[model samples]
Target: MAIRNPMYCGKIFIEKYKDEDCHLVKGLHEPLITETMYYEVQDILDGKKRKSKLTIMSPSMLPLRGFLNCNRCNRVLCGSASKGRGNYYYYYHCSSKCGYRKKAEEINKAFVDELKLYILNDESKEFFKTAIMDAYIDATKGETKDKTNWIVEITELGNRITKARELLLTGDLDGSDYKTIKTESEHRIAVLEAKLSEAPVVAVSPAEVERLLDKAIVKLTQIDVIYSNHDTYVQREVIGSMYPEKFTFENLQHRTANVDFLFQLIYQINSTLREKKRRASDRKTCLPIVAPEAGLEPATL
Candidate 1:
């Protein structure tokens, strides 16, 4: 009986195996390749070494990532990973032909620092608070109940329910009929209750705005740390909330600062900062970039 290499007994068997009786060998010579290399070869053959087609998303980072746009091409910057010498690195890159790429850490730090500075200043901080309050109020503007309409509807539903109950009590209607009417009335009441529950309670008051602003300021001050380690999704959410516009970079030869909606806000907050920074000095100073002016109004919610 021919002794067989155990590794070759299964899928590795040769064409002649069917014609011969094979016996497993008790002892075999050392492997031709190191264990590590053998595994690597197997992985390659099995397509295990192939790059994954899955997208990576970090929920914590969504607050900051999606809002940034490419200064060169005006395209939304997207997160991507690349394999370097022996490790992978993540970066935000412009998807357009301009191909602007920056390390995610670098871009996030620079932007967050700028945001923090804007938020920390008294004038800008106040303006930011007002803007946020305005946004909240606008979001909840239509939630107030039309009392007359609701009263009428509720009364009709109540009467129907009462009639159904009376029919059941007096035996004027069969069990099935009573049940059907009662169920319909109960469903109507439930629907109205749900609508009331969903309605906005009230606009955030001025006092509440002050409290919220304080919290936002604290978070903004630590934005560098928050953004650096935050998940991609949270980073994106922060950015989207801010609604950054395309940054227009000028005087590239001298490394002029990129101009965008947020930059405009910074300028409004501190005009002197632009004067001292010659790079962005040429850009026209505009009014505080409002949500409406920037066309960043949320779609009708």
Candidate 2:
């Protein structure tokens, strides 16, 4: 704790040694770290920057272990392999005494079948493509506006720094005040520049967006095939992306899962169209309206 403290940078403690009360004394036992480096370390210590969670490796054979819940007790189902007659059999069973269990092969095959349900039909595909493209354009518009604002703020900070220097030279501002102004402005400029760098600089052309959407649609349509081909690790990731909540398995069938927003949209659009096509009604069968211009709002079915 003391190594990266302000004292390492030749800061002299005053009174109770509070941060704001400290003084920077030069030629004090040779500075160990730069001022910026000390503050950066302090930020980490203060948790201004978050640490990524440690990932524990799951067994390859039990991809669905943590994702499936016991239907009776609602506890997570654990997977294990049992040996009988010199052969191994894997099963996903309840953690409690519910005695609920299913063959891993059975549940795995059922999950693949579930993925097939999300495959987009031709009509649904056209709707999804149009809607998604419009949404992407609107999102890019917001990002572009944000980038413009950041650039303006950065320019304004630079102007402030220049003005502060001029004031310092004219004796209108004291050295401490001028230094404070420059330091704060430079910090703000750095933050804004970082944001600007992350924001998209060039607008994606409609043709490029269409190409990306084509690839996305291909993957979406072949979700089952893609998932089937993935290793257990990737397959679990695919499941997690599709279904955020753990689902229950009872009577050899998967219970309803609250899927990701995009998949919910896909299921709604595809199922609704299919249902409308099957039903005979005097009213015109209009497709569900999707307002892509609405920012971050789910499409209305």
Candidate 3:
């Protein structure tokens, strides 16, 4: 939910690269969060962070209960209802004293409306699908560079790990310090090793890509409908697939996703579409799309 990366606090970040611990040390960049402020933020986040409640509730009107949290204090919303004249009115309130409350119906409708932003028409959808398929298959052909980088990373981690153990044995570094570096180095090694051990990805055929894109287009177009039809738990699961972190909700609106690259790509395409206009004679318009991580090769068509 929060990115309190220690690198922003005037720290050189590496597990076993520096002589000291992996935490903040003197760095060239200006610190964003002071040591005191960093600790306070950590305490607050640690205290507030909690696993989403998984208890399956029976048929209920408030299906978006645990899917949203308090925008102010990051607390799971509590849903309740009160009998008003003949019908019951439902609302979601923050557990903390944030004075934040919104009608359940409004939140649910707003969330569904928000999901509509991802829907793309036939042309744009096909363009992105082709770009993605090309990138995926292209990655498989020239993977030697990636494999070499992984091998170098694994070798560095191994060397650091060996040095850390020798320092601990020679009494140059204390057991606690050695353990910290060792754990960090081991984690890095394990991750790289797993990647190295995996079978190489075989490129999908042209027909397969077509079928995959057809299925994807169906899913993309029906995202909102699928989300609306599901129960609260399943709805949240759909949201979690796209947004791994908990998003903020305030002023009767859900916050925009910042970390999800898929959403970012969609936004860029939509923005380009909005900025361009034709003479109404030629309907074809081209938008340049780029994603370095997904094979930086840009597409313009």
Taking all chains together, each candidate's TM-score versus the true structure is 0.35, 0.52, 0.51
Model 1 C-alpha lDDT per residue in residues 119-238, reported as the tens digit of each score: 435445666556667766676554544534655787898998788788888988888988888788778878887776676566567578678768976775455566556666655555
How much RMSD separates candidate 2 from the native structure?
A: 17.0
lDDT of each: 0.58, 0.80, 0.70
- Between the candidate structures 2 and 3, which one is better when assessed by TM-score? 2
- Give a tens-digit lDDT track for model 2, residues 1-301: 5655567876765554655664555545777887787777777778897655677655666778888888888889989999999998899998787899988888877777777878776789988998788887887878778888988999899999999999999999999999999999999999998887786566667689899889888888878777778787788888899887888765226437678877888888898988887775524555545545655886554
Model 1: weakest 10-residue lDDT segment is 246-255
Runs of candidate 2 with Cα error greater than 4 angstroms are 1-61, 140-209, 250-255, 279-301
Q: Is candidate 2 or candidate 3 better by lDDT?
A: 2
lDDT of 1: 0.58
